[model samples]
Target chain A: MQSLTALLGLLNLIFFKPYNAIKMNHLNKISILFFLLLNLFFTACEKDNPTPGEDFGTFDLIFDNRVGDQAVSLVNADATEFPYTNNMGQSFNLTLLGYYISKIELAGPNGEYFADEISTGADAAQVKGFYHVLESDPNSQNIRLDRIPAGKYDQVTFTLGIDAETVQEGATGGVLDPAEGAWLWNWDAGYIAFGIEGRSPASPREADQFNPENGVQIHIGGWKDIAGNANMVNNVKRITLDFPSAVNIESRLSPNAHLEMDLLKVLDGHANNVDFSTTYAVHAPAKGKVFADNLAAAFSVDHVHQ
Target chain B: MHFSNLYSFSNSLFGIGLLALLLSSCTREKGIAPVAVAYEFAAPAEFPDPIYTFKNNPITKEGFLLGKRLFFDPILSADHTISCASCHIQSLAFADVPLHGVSVGVNGLSGTRNAPALANLAFKPEFFWDGGVTHLDFAPLNAIESEFEMGSCIEDVIEKLNAHPQYPSLFRQAFTTEKVTTPYLLYALAQFMNRMISDQSPYDQYLAGTAKLSEPEIRGMDLFQQHCASCHDGILFTDYSYRNNGLDSLAIDPGRARISAFAGDHGKFQVPSLRNVGVTAPYMHDARFRTLEAVLDHYSEGVVASPTLDMSLQRGDQLGIQLTDSEKAAIIAFLHTLTDRDFLNDPLFRRE
Candidate 1:
């Protein structure tokens, strides 16, 4: 009964205006403390609420080739140990495995390709030299886009090779320029499209650990038939990012997040075949398509953090 | 006394007003009106569509002025003595004056191949006699940086441009980028060259039915249709495909093979477009011929027998296509029709 009466009295004091409530001894001090507590509660709520362009609200569509986490990879679709080799004695371990990802589009929920792709690479000075070298050391690459507009992009679409229209017609700056080496042909007029390299003990080429004699130089590029190559011009490559929850393009994605990609699947293909003498070479349209499809899947949304 | 003073004051005010109006009228007449320059480039109506339609880069008064400044500015050269016009002279359809088989640049230094004239460049798919540089915008780099030609690096050229007081703003106005890089500069150069489209020749007028080919010219056209049209396809004139036209089966220079590194591509050279073939003479990569008759003689029976000689050239190449004196005259007449007297003297391409 005393507690009930005390609660009623406290409620009455709260309902009353401060001047009236602060009537008893020490009443003024108690009112001041109550107001301070109310202010802190509202401030905390405002701080927690996030909006577009806020620090927490962000989306970085990352691309990666998982391939056994760049450590030990599977060969011939078999659960082989790390650093495994495929049938034609093809092995793994890459240093700078990178190439130009010219055009990219993120798929919307309703399956529309939205193209807002752009490039940020080596400075004008660096691009002018080294026509044959690709720069993919550690974590410097990944079409890291400018803070994109805030919205949930359901699916992502991207092209594998350079757009012929952009290349043939001409672009004065960016990756397409010959001086950059991203798109280069020393003795002719074509471009080196895709590149993937690693430490392959399986390759007879890199056997000389001391002197470096034989190592498989698997370089695949040229103007392939656009009609079939999925990485070709005008092809809309849609990869769905079926998030369990909502995603925000402008907010809610984190940085320093790793999107592990699996390149073994890209090469091995879905047929469960990895004969790789001529078959594993992947020089045909079907191989290009397989590479593109598997590469798209490898870009599944990873954990987001600082 | 008051009335007289007021009258004098009124008269003075009127005098001041008249002087102000007269001053304003004089200033208006002398003021510069921003040079309202007019310009346009057109392809022949009857001809096939142009390959280079000035899409992103158009021919504007400012753009043309920028091109003209760069063309004349020796700042483009390494030593700053030779401009592009040094080799590509205006009077000769913008082709090098055939001093020898190849062109001589800075200090009379000789390069590998002859510099072809800049005519109907907009229609050309491949550039150079051997069809090397893929994009037209990037061609200036080869010339600017070639050790034999201008002998300047692109970065060096950019540095020179950046130092200039007026060029930065001028380049910015032409291309939106503040920093004038090689590609933008090359693009501007190409715009200038590509716009050098010359289709207003008498032959064009004849095709339009506005004029008629002369009797000799008609006969020349017939012969050209019979012999030349197979290789020199249409408006821009050449098929633009690389072929071994019996220049040499095993050329020391290794024409197209230098790029392709292919076995079969030993002496293959891009078919030369014969648009302004008359004035832009001393033809072929080597510029071996001194006259049109010499060129005709080569086609008539001088083509060498080689493993890679064009099958069409089996009959002596030039030896078989040999023209009799009258036949030569007829063929020469047809070649003359291709001369665009109007383009040679086009005021737009002329120096301001």
Candidate 2:
């Protein structure tokens, strides 16, 4: 009975003495719970109001894929009627068309710069700011950038594909995830920054699964610059476009920049007038360098809506 | 009366402890910090810093186990008939059996290149005969999607994994995600492969001063340093450079040229590590030589001429290395010391 008293005393000294010194009572318990609740409330409030007294708004980037003046209408691979014609008078119809956009930056006339948060990791939540714009998926074409400080933005810059640094970060999820329809070259081990697959009469009849008879697949991908290997190419292009007019981003107003990517410009650029017959099957980086060179001129900021 | 008072005091103390536990559990639900069971990954002292980006995917016990299951499971294959383990058996130092010169995949389709032994992969900057794959995470995609291998795309594999009863929960436990993604899948596999460090070989033990080599083995080691050390240098025994090694007269497979797209790289293949070379017979990228004797014989007298052939193999008009029968036997005896039995028989890598 004496030993039990000693044990109780020890327990009281170890666990309860600190609380006792603080005057533990019903009121203290109530106050502690209140403080925890206050912490939870403040954390919740912090997220909504990241920067107090600062005006912020959402900015939308609308990618409008077009074949010259007409909007891109994705045709079936087996479709016989070709809707688009190149400068070389070769008729072609696209079955699939897409490109990865990352490292977005917006510049204002007043020197206000906003660079989108870029991160790559195994977790889907950690992988951010990578937009895979596909012709088939209309929803993917619209990218909404939140928490933009209110400013009159005049220009926007973005990378056409996943950069070499991001590729070296190893496997990434979200839009960069290959399982979710990401164009990845497994053998070469890099993301295809831009890709176009379609049927053209000028293309030779190569009766393979990926390349059906008269099938044209132009995949621009390669993000490694090995030292002393001049033959190796980096096709990732940085595209900068000037907005037609300065658009105000305020809490009440969510401005949108509609950018048009013209397919005809890509095929008929001054650098290399793509002859679809011979240049139909472009799967390597060197093979697609000519097409990737035209990507900068292919994109143009058509309009901005405030 | 005093004892009763003490009991009540002790009861109140217990109540306070319960309250604290409840509050801590609430904080955990808020996701302040995730509790991960860490698995230690330490490189051998002689090895260089690992090339794998471990910061992106830290090694956890759960993640390693998930990866091990994936490695052994045939579900990654199209018809569910072939697994990574089907070609890469653990007993043979993760190399295919001798009969399988080139690994047979789904629907009994044979691969073109010989299945290389997987050991000390974390140290390698590149993978495969052509050295096309730059990252370990991206390596499996080739095997999974290749027509001559697993014959399944990453999309279908993810779909299949999501449909599995246990895989989704296992992945969730490993990666802390609601859905299994490609990165997590690759991370798990990489985690498993990275742990396959072969540092317990007799040669390694000799270097560590725990064991000693025989007279012939010592002589062979000296000869190896004199002849082979220029290419197969350091602890891993590979310089990781692309070389033709006089495999053929003409570039038939277009090996490294397929990746580099250069005529200079034609017929060139990455120098494979000689670790576990004793067990990984059916040698070279094409699996041309079935025995170590034949491999040495090729090095001695059978090196064919090629435009992109390694300069080391040619000494003016001489095409190959000069080695007698005794020297070849001694070299083979030394090569046997590289086999790490502990790594080959580790039950941790076995299917549970």
Please tell me what DockQ candidate 1 reaches.
0.12
Candidate 2 lDDT by residue in tens digits, A1-43: 3344445446545544556535787766676566556545554
After superposing candidate 1, which stretches have Cα over 4 Å from the reference? Answer: A1-98, A106-114, A118-140, A145-157, A174-250, A255-306, B1-38, B106-109, B209-212, B257-264, B315-322
Angstrom error at residue B93, model 2: 1.3
True contacts kept of 2: 0.89
Candidate 2 structure quality by residue, lDDT tens digits, B1-352: 1011111222235675455445545545353442321245678899999988988887777788899999999999999998899999888888899999999998889999999899889889888999888889999999999989999999999999999999999999998889988998999999999988889899999999999999999989988888888999999999998888887899678888888878899998989899888899899999989999999999998999988899999999999898999999898899999988877876667786
Q: In candidate 1, residue B298 scores what lDDT? A: 80
Error of 2 at A279 (Å): 2.4
